[model samples]
Target: ETLVLTYDVIANDGDTDSNTQTVTITITGTNDGPVASGSYEHQIVDGPGADTYDDITGQLRASDPDHEVDELTWTLPDGQGQYGTLTVNPDGSYTYEVDEAAVNGLTDGDNPVDSFTVVVTDPSGASDTRTINISLSGTNDTAEVSGVDEGEVIEAGGGDPGVPTTEGTLLAVDADNPDNRFQPDSGRGSNGYGNFVVDEDGNWSYTLDNDNPEVDALNEGDTLTDTFVVRTEDGTEAQVTITIRGTNDPAVIDGDDSGTVVEAGANGPGEPVAEGTLSSGDVDNPDNVFQLEMGEGDSGYGNFVVDESGNWSYTLDNDNPEVAALNDGDTLTDTFVVRTEDGTETQVTITIRGANDPAVIGGDDTGLVVEDDAENTVGGTLTASDVDNPDNLFEPASGVSNGGYGSFVVDANGNWTYTLDNNNIAVDALYEGETLVDSFVISTADGTSRVVEITILGRDEPEVLHPVHIHRHDSGGDLWVPEVEGFDTGSSRPSGSFDRSLDFVANWLRESSEHEGVVARLWAALKPRDRLVYTSDPFTFNLQAGTFLHTDPGASLVLEATLKSGAPLPGWLYFDRETGEFSGIPPEGYEGEVHIRVVAKDSDGREAQVQFTIKVVDEQEVGMLLEETPQDDTSNEQTLRGKAGFSAQVAAEAGGNDLQAGARALVASLQALEN
Candidate 1:
């Protein structure tokens, strides 16, 4: 090797003097490290539905300051990457290939970067190290799911279902995503027959909703095949199939068939009236047809018939006596059992409403009478005819004239007689040639009335009147009295005191007007108001009782009580005639209102009555004042005694001496009766 240097020199003393010199030298050249630089990038493509991919190729660009790029040899130390293999040639060319299993396992957004060391050297064996980076971009891969091939289920009404319907399991897989699972919220679907569901673990099941009416639409021995599509989270769809078989169903008859028709003769028995249609269905039969059971109908007052197509008609017997007896607004119901050919039965009710037909009466409307006649009577017969009301008769058999001239009587057969009273003032005042007319109203069973007038002709008689002498006498005498043995002086003090009290009461009641007023006031005050009593509680009611105002102190007066209907009181109730009180405990399970009527009467047959009601309830009508106790069949005597005692104590505190005396007397009388 040779070296040369060229220079120019100049002295500081002169500016015009300059020289150019050249020198030659020899040196040895040694190989230095080749500088290396390169960068590589590659993208892996995964087409839709494509699984396998080829290797990725890249160039390791390098530049050496001392040698040509071709002369710089490239070497890779550790050519293995995490996901692929990297190879570099001595010519600075390289390739990176991802493992087949790793490529197949790549999912969306999976990018892998690989790195290796590259050494560039000259022929002299001097080298420089550089890092080569290989980067790869990922592509999306397709996902897949498995399908449920076939399944079987029984239709509704096919007998008991011992086991659930089973279909094949569904499976899903994604090589790019090894942890693939089904999304249940978006993976469940339904069809007309059943619903399909898939769990997160890719397990699937199909449940038959047997309650659907479509399941019963299939006939016996019929099969229905249904198919449905299910999807995965990545929009992968699969088909599932189900086959449903059918069974027999029973015949059914509609139970609510009824009709209302106006009775015949309202318009003269024109035609038979139509009821409603009778409907029946049999799903197992062809065309769901049903036949009516023929010759099985009856009606008391009419003819009932049904046809094959479920139409019915009723024709009333207008001429029948019972049918004709029905009044206006009267109704009768006829029931008939209708059936299908399969013996399914339902009842059909037909109601007949009645209308009235006017009645006719034929007879004389006027009559004549003679005051001089021996009997002084006018008589006649009447005839009545009614289409709707047969065998009619007059309502009242006898009656009296409004005028004081006469009276009238009639029989059920319409035979009537009007007789004039000879002693009547109006009849006696009549003079010769004068006439009096009397009218009476008569009615038939149908409330049809007619007025009949009778004219009485006056006549003169020549019989003379006679008078007899009368005598009167007045006498006065003293009446004798006898004393009883027990009442002569006194037997026991209590008995004498009781007798004296009774005598005072009787005398005071008979002589004192104040006593009558007091009694009336007491009666009015004691009248019980309407009360609500709960069952299982004792009830005590004091009714208004009083004695009639009569001059005779010994007049027998009694009070009796009973139900408003004149029926005897119930066994649970007791009426004390002396106290005019009704006390009883209503038994369990008894609830209703009891209407009581109390009557006070005297020996003279005069009566005074008052009615009141006691409503019995199962629950407390008023607000509770104390804690409730369990109710049973036991009597509520404690509660009754407490109330009665409180009332008696209050009366005693109020200084009612008469009430106290009466209470004492009552107690004594009760004791005596018990003894």
Candidate 2:
């Protein structure tokens, strides 16, 4: 500090000399250092490669009372040695340009900001400082994807995030920011699943994108390994390799269900109608085998028979009568359930259509007839029907019989007739307790033929002549006639052989009157009986009692008679008690003369007793066959004796029983001629 003393010299010089006074100066101490009026701070971006502060160095109006501002120099205060190089101008200004390279080189935990002081100093070493903070903050690091801790497993289809699924999502994060985005790097191995989806808020997901060839190629149970990089503005990254595994998918099946087919193999519902294999596809395990279950959920719709290799066919239950009765245009459906190797079931439908079924014949396979003495033979007839065609007819083909088989006749109206043939070979081959069978063929207009078996039944009764000569003489001059109860009042013979007249005689005998002796004698004398005289040993006479010649054993032959009669002609005649019918085969070893006595009563109770004589000839000892009669062939029309003989048609009409009888009669006539 300085004080000035001044003296003024005037031109009226001598007189103004007193006016110019003398000034004395004194030095005083004043504490006036450099004062600053401005404050400033700067922050640099600290970009990756390079950065410019663009004159970030600010100005401070710093001045010193005793020193020129130009004399003042600027000094930078080091704050924790953070301030690097700085240039200050004479105007109390220091331009700051951040070293972007050095700032970027800082470590993660290193201080990213540098704060220092701007000091103004005079030549006297007077100085004042202001804090000018210079901060270096990085732009940002790469975004981080979080929440992908475990491997992801998808159904090979798709998945939703945070929905309790084995599939997961990824979250992107920047430690310095809340808003971030993540995406798979283009070079990453995302081909297996393609590129996953990412939202603006950092959400990751996987979806089925068939449009993408990679996603379309994904199969069930297939696994994929891929890597991706997540990034932010600073080009930092997080390399994450996620394992994505796939799961299975179901198969698809297609069928031809609308086709209609006729039946095969005898044209029945249970038989197969069509043949084919359904088309199927599966991405995973496509080569696996497929099988058709017994039914498609409903068994009643029928079923399918499939081969191990998946060949299939449709069939119906023709064994069911309802199905068998179907007509043309009738339909039967079957459902098929197909199962894959993995046991997945798929259902399909198949149908069958009927057309032109064969004609059906009604009646038993066998026709049974009883030769009731040949006068009233009992037989049956046959009928035919066609469920498919209404105007079908049955025709007669060649038939074989010896006269015991029933006659067969068909009219244009499809009506048929069958008359019993009593004179057949069965008559001779069958004995009193035996049976015989004859076979024949019958046909339909459609060229179909079926074999019909004929069984002739017979029984031995008391020999009944046109003029039966059985009579008994009573004391009152009344004649008692013996009646064969098994013989009907008409020309026919009845069925039952046992007589109820025996009880009448027993009752008569039990109730004795004063003329009881005479009544008793009359009862004893008057009983049903018959007489038979046959001249031969081992006579083969047709008769039937028990079962027909069939594989089944429970067959029966029942006999019922009205004409009261005593025991039927016994001799070779044997009655089956169970069947109440005379047997066909006679008793063994029955020799020459055997008597059969019978007591019979007519419907009027006129009873009498009669006897029969059977002169059995030992067949071995007798000359049963002619010496050279050319073996009596009935199939030929000509005769051995140069005379007209019965034709094969006649022989067949006669049946086996009658054929044998005719042969015997012819033999007898020849014998008579010889004798």
Cα-based lDDT for every prediction:
0.57, 0.43
RMSD of each: 27.2, 21.7
Return the TM-score for each candidate structure: 0.35, 0.37
Q: Distance (Å) between predicted and true CA of 22, model 2?
A: 38
Give residue 586's error in model 2 in angstroms: 32
Q: Between which residue pairs do clashes occur in model 1?
A: none
Candidate 1 global TM-score = 0.35
What lDDT tens digits, residue by residue, belong to model 1 across residues 1-675? Answer: 334554444435457765554444445555566776655555555444436667777666656565777887888888998768888888877777777556656556777766778787877677887776655555544557665657787765534462346656667676565434656633323457777766666566677766667666666688766666655555556677778787555456663477766655533453336466766676655432445444423666666666666666666666656556667778777667665554455677767677664467778656888886887888887778876676547776665553336788977878889988776534554556766666566777776666676787877655332211011113421111112111112122221122212111111111122311212211111234566788889978665323222323234547787776455788888999888778999899999988876665556554444456778889887743222211111342112111112111111121222221222111111111100
Question: What's the residue-level lDDT of 52 in candidate 1?
Answer: 66
Give the best candidate by lDDT.
1
